[model samples]
Target: MNCLLFTWRKGDGKLKIHEVRKQLTTPLGAPAYPWGPYNFRNREYLNILYRTDMEALRRVVPEPLAIDEPLVKFEVMYMPDAPGLGAYTEAGQVIPVSFNGEKGEYLHAMYVDNHPAIAVGREVSAYPKKLGAPRLYIDSDTLVGTLDYGSLRVATATMGYKHQPMDLALARQELSQPTFMLKIVPNTDGSQKVCQLMRTQINNPTIHGAWTAPARLQLFAHALAPMADLPVLEVISASHIITDLTLSKPDVIYDYLAEH
Candidate 1:
């Protein structure tokens, strides 16, 4: 069966433009496809889990959702190849949040090199995705990543690779949990078009390797995007996981514009 993307009546005529869906999953009937023709082989992740000030955390986190433990996860992923979207690198910040008593990870800021991935991520899950130059590489025993906004370096993270083996079961469980994000779009007239809370879960993720070590995270102030607002207080854990994760369906939790 074919799916319809969008339709608009032109002038007084009934001529309409319709596009067929290509990707496996889409929003209800939206012409857009599900993110990822996702298959990752030896995908590398260098992550740092750290504690931050409660005040700093509160400022960055949106209302209605409360911070769980003032913790933040900064991760760098090197995807040599991915389905649909080609090779790309990504770095981002995630906060431990609880909404309506349900615990989930909230995506704070995500930067990637590919435009297609950014577009699809925003459309599908309301992910706060931005286009930037991000690189993840291994140098000797250290795994490092940097996010660059034009010429300015905004974030950096480093970790010791495979320093210690992590419990595969616990690591898998943590990676498989649900994640929340804010999906916001503006109308042409400069008004809020869509603002909603989005929830998504990982699908059939296979963990091939998992390692842990002490890590470091740094965020610098940017004139455009201020990631430094979420200051780091203490480094909790650093982990590296090689796995393949499928981006699953997204569910909208709350619509801010809905009239009760």
Candidate 2:
């Protein structure tokens, strides 16, 4: 058929294949986000460290990573300006874990209000990022952070405004720890294509300011957003930090399906 021949001719484009091969991200011509390393200028964070149930912590953390303690960090972050991804608000829960005797934090659950952030986080790294409503701002005398999923508030955190200044050296040391994540990509036939533990370490970031404050956090039960699954037992410590940092691309450390 002439129509069939025309369609085949239209479909047979040689340059597009070469162009796609040379590209960095998804889509043939248009990418959702630009290539990394994404730089954040004056990134602010409201980090709330709390104690949680040890048994609950073991359920989500995968193998090879030993739970350092019965602890979880609830963080709400606001980025003023990010190149290629623009500014976005993010909030999530991370668990402190140890891999081969080295202390690190595991990427558990992250929610961002920006599409580019959600795409880049999952596509590039194994970051468990989803699209949700997260806000980080300051009220009259308290710093407030909240996460909402479909009109239901999943987590809320409040902190006193900058009570004591945190030492910059100690802050940098804490931030430089390696972050581990489970990267799982499925194959076309629904079988497992890729399952590995990925790691990334942030190093030599310029810290602008850091502070510790009395704070409180509450996690509500949500079917989709399972921040309450860990069940915050007690608020241990809280910190509000502002810094300029760079997000590093992850490297595969352990392949779950590798030969024994």
Q: For model 1, how does the per-residue alpha-carbon lDDT over 22-108 read when each residue is reduced to its tens digit?
A: 334444465344445457666778878888888988887886788879899887888886777778888888898989998889899
- lDDT for 209 in candidate 1 is 89
Q: Which stretches of candidate 1 lie over 4 Å from their true place?
A: 1-37
Model 2 C-alpha lDDT per residue in residues 3-75, reported as the tens digit of each score: 3433333366555544556887877578999888899999998999999999999999999999978999999
lDDT of 1: 0.80
Best by lDDT: 2
Q: What TM-score against the true fold does each predicted structure earn?
A: 0.85, 0.93
**Roughly what TM-score does model 1 have, to 2 decimal places?**
0.85
Worst 10 residues of 1 by lDDT: 14-23
CA lDDT for candidate 2: 0.90
